[model samples]
Target: MWMKAVLVALLAFALGYLYHTNPMLQNQTLHLITQSIPQSLFSSQHEPNSANLEETISRAWDALITAPTRQWGRIAVGVNACIDVVVSGVNLLQALALDPGYGHDHDVLHSKEDLKETFIHYMERGAAAERFFSDKEVFQRIARAAAEFPGSQVYVGGNAALMGQKLASYPELEVLLCGPVGPKLHELLDDHIVVPPQSLQETDEFHLILEYKAGERWASSQAPQANRFILSHDVSNGEMSTLETFLDSLDEFQPRLVVLSGLHMMEGMGRALWENRIKEFAVAIADVRNEAPIHLELASMTDREYMSIITKEQVLPMVNSIGLNEQELLFLSQAGGGPHSDLHSWSGIPDVGRVSDILLWILEQHGQADPDSEAHLTRIHFHTLAYHVLVTVDGHWRNQRSTVAAGARVASSQACGLQAVDVSKVELKAPLSFYSSFTEPKESLVLDPSNPVTVWQRRNVSFHLSPVLICKQPLRTVGLGDAISAEGLVYSEIVSQLHLD
Candidate 1:
């Protein structure tokens, strides 16, 4: 028995050494890791029974043929910081007993106790971010390690040390987490932590994710057709001081690209408050624009009902680009009273022509309604499980060559990010099978030269679609959107810089 144990240990050490040193072996190991993850970990309890899934996949392939390519460069991302406690494979109906008529799917939880209880339940189930770091030194070490990616700097505002913890692994990346030093936040950060300019002195808040597996039968408590809910303790996030601090960080970081997220938590807080916050943010962004060009992108997992408030208060005068899923786009169309308001239902597969029309309508409405507004949306992106579609207005900051290439790169990075999360791997890179899956041709839809409905072209805007690498059995879907948005935005910035050089 002793001899056998020794032999096994020796073999394991050898294998580990080979995996570390050999690139091919490392790739094989990643593939094996991806394949070994259980479908139950992230698959939805309700599977699609309709035949439209194949149709959607086919349309996505047709869209991929038009993807353009470009050179890549280095970019920095400055984000309003918040922690995401991702709890996968949850049954929304069973866990929250949510009623479908409450509001809409993906609404924020208003009750603090209810939110706390949900967090506790998921923490017991081995969810990450359960415990705040007891020691500030340990937290700093972890954060420093995660920010190692070369030519990138991540400035996390507010007191989300846990969110910053993940970026510590990328040693070459520069990372800064700035916020007040309260007893709670102080405990999370070192006493010597340097607060960034204009940082608010307040406690941190958390974003709770009760993610259900894909293909699950669970119905949305508020919207029966919907299957997910993203609850956040973000009422404090809307305070004037917090917004000011976030703006200050923007000035200090001077990031080329900014991703505005977590605004849905401000629901029920009153329209005045929302308007004030947006005004402040817009003003700050305008100030920054005087020094350098900044690309502003808005990404949210908010409920459908909040689209109106967001469109009027935030998006109209500020955002240069918007990234959302198909459902969100449909909701935006309805909220904006566009031509596609009837598109309330999704049939698993997304229609490229319909989606293109919705985007065009959104752009046209923004142009007509806010004619006096200085900022115009240059790009509108809709990402679905099947593929990603990007519509670029002709005179936007990016040209066709750059936008198409950047979109394709973003799609590829998103596929790897999803696969990595599904398999519990932290690396952003995935195996070749992942890339191949995205570009593979399917026989469902063929492009015709004479077809009247040009799905990829409208009046002043041209659309670029790239099919995603499908994970037939996903293990987790909670952070996939954020992963895609963040990676894509960073990659786009990099490509833009390279083009400038």
Candidate 2:
């Protein structure tokens, strides 16, 4: 009888151990990426997969910059910084029920508070993340590194508000690309800014990616048409792995200027993957640039320090090989202004003007490919000039309730199409909202169409819209500038709206 009891106890113990380590059950866990994702997720295989380069780049960017939103879209970063709640909830319950001995000695799972403490420790250990962000050193380093990109332009896209507040000297614009349907929440609510277009063209200049934000449907659908000579694409999380493979397969379509924006709003996990993939792709771009010439511009709303080390340390250095400074390579947080600046609220005319100037400066910078072209890219120049007028209008109509007329008048006057969409006539199978800022704002947005709210509305805001072009146009026509205003306004409005989709 004693021998039989011992044999039974040993068999049960073995069974419990096996059950805990079961591959099938572990595969279903939330941390599967860390445990089961292939080794290739961290590897950089440079063999050109020409057929899927665009998809590959898009996926890589999404994983690195937008993973939080894509993967953990339901969680808030500040209030619910720890991922332990959801991840550990079900696991703890199961452990208690199936294996009573699991937490007996640990005692960490005895009560709710104990379980919470255990979760914090376990999550940190499992994810291998630092307890707190080391912002001071990273920011100082970023500020210093930015100085290297003399005359470089900065563009901000993402959900972090601190980033915008940091870039006091540069220009910044926040763009929301994906809806907050995932486990992460990317919120930067502003009152009124237009969205950009979805179509991208493959041209000799570079590859441009324009992402949409949550809400602002009218603004998002109206972005500028893809340039005939350039390539563009909007990325997502599901496609990240494929994007990595595609980037590795670049044989013919080696883009000289690569622009990645609208990721600050993503969750930590997504951002981590995004940074890693971007670092890998940066090397690939560098390899191509070595054979030719390439310039890469990454627009971000997160603080320089918050971004993945791959981008802050690795990717930027790779781009600098041909000598583009960190500022030109990555959009510093300051460019987007401060935490007070929301994507929904109207930005001040000065802020708008500053961003336009920066855009022109960026577009005008002569890349390694165009060594002698001192003139700014004509299209980008026109866009910059037109954006100036849009900002002025935004400032002028900041306090107005019914902004359609103001938007239309500005669009008509500036020759840019800026119009509000009739929500009654719109189709929204997936009506979602997402936001990014230089500084993380309090409750970036509230998606209650019945109340129709923006971050600006909740925060109380105002802005000025002014349109101006600093650089000399190819044709020095005076009145032509005013005449072009209306068209520019319409174009800018449309482009802005495109981002809202």
Number of backbone-clashing residue pairs for each candidate, in the order shown: 31, 115
lDDT of 2 by residue, 284-328 (tens): 655544432222222223344434353344443343211111122
Q: 1-501 in candidate 1: lDDT tens per residue? A: 465456546645765786568633643554454345432221222222212222323233334334223322222333345543444323323333433222222133334334334433332322222122223443343333323323222222322342233232234334444433334444544333334644534555444344443334323222111122344434455343355555556555544444444354344355666666656656676665444344443434334445676676545445566666776677677877865577545554555556666777777766322344465566666666655666666655343333333444434334444412222222122121121111223112222211111234456666655545454444444444544454344334322333233
The lDDT for every candidate, in the order shown, is 0.43, 0.25
lDDT of 1: 0.43
Scanning candidate 1 in windows of ten residues, the lowest lDDT window is 429-438
Against the true structure, candidate 2 reaches a TM-score of 0.25
Worst 10 residues of 2 by lDDT: 75-84
